[model samples]
Target: MDDAGIYTRESEYLDCYVQLGLASDRVLAVSFPEESDDEDADHALLDRIDAYLEGEREEFDDVAVALTVPTDQREVLETTREVPYGEQVSVERLTRMTPGLDASSDEDHDAVRTALAANPAPLVIPDHRVRDGPSGAPPEIEQRLRALEGL
Candidate 1:
């Protein structure tokens, strides 16, 4: 990137669904379409996504993503990131899977949904792995991610 923070998250991947900033391969952010602007694609980072889409099991394990989510939702996001590459889980299930999460509590449930809706990194974090519940990711992105997972 020409400048660290100056580099926009927008990049030239199909539909520009991914926007990321890397200085010496350390990720600054991987944002959504609305959250990104045109920036150079980190080919190596993109390659891992492509590899996963092409049926490779691993997904973005080596790529670091910088996020600014609230502490209240950190457990949810971290748990979502651990979802198996080709598996799907409902938001309810995610909440239950997360330690000390109470899916039955409306406040906790909303917190989980809100965190997912604002997920900046879709494929990398695989928010689309969420099924039978609201997915905050773009429809196209969610569809594509599901397709890759063979769902």
Candidate 2:
């Protein structure tokens, strides 16, 4: 695993983890291999993170992206579009899980929870597609939630 340094001014950081012989170009262009238990592996990782967070074993403020392999392909692929692996949930929904807050409150804990549960794992999107949108929550939030839930 390699730390890609913080793009803090842009509110982002890149971390790359390499798997043996996993072609970066192919992995980005296609879905995970059908025969590989990648989904289960991903879930297990999420579970571990959740447990660590819930047990207060670690501290985090928002979710961070996980790149399986390091590459210079930060730009979006023009030919290959990404299809989300799971249900699409809006950022609004995730923020609903935070307690003691109204729907309009920006820092509601329920809203944070909603975001965490809705998108439990890091998502893969084209580099060009990534943008600094309206939601300014830091990447550490995901870590905080996992510790809160002790998943």
Q: Highest TM-score, which number?
A: 1
- Kindly provide the TM-score of model 1 when superposed on the true structure, using C-alpha atoms: 0.75
> Highest lDDT: which candidate?
1
lDDT of 2 by residue, 11-116 (tens): 1111222121112222211121213323233332234343542343432213233333312112111110131222223334323322333547665433343333
Candidate 1 ranges with C-alpha deviation above 4 Å: 1-17, 23-28, 31-42
Candidates' RMSD to native: 3.9, 15.5
Across 1-151, the per-residue lDDT of candidate 1 in tens digits comes to: 4334424333333355455556655565555565543554556565665566557787665566666677766677778888887888888888888887898887777878887887766777778888865565668767766886786
lDDT of 2: 0.27
TM-score of each predicted structure versus truth: 0.75, 0.21
Residue 49, candidate 2: Cα error in Å is 13
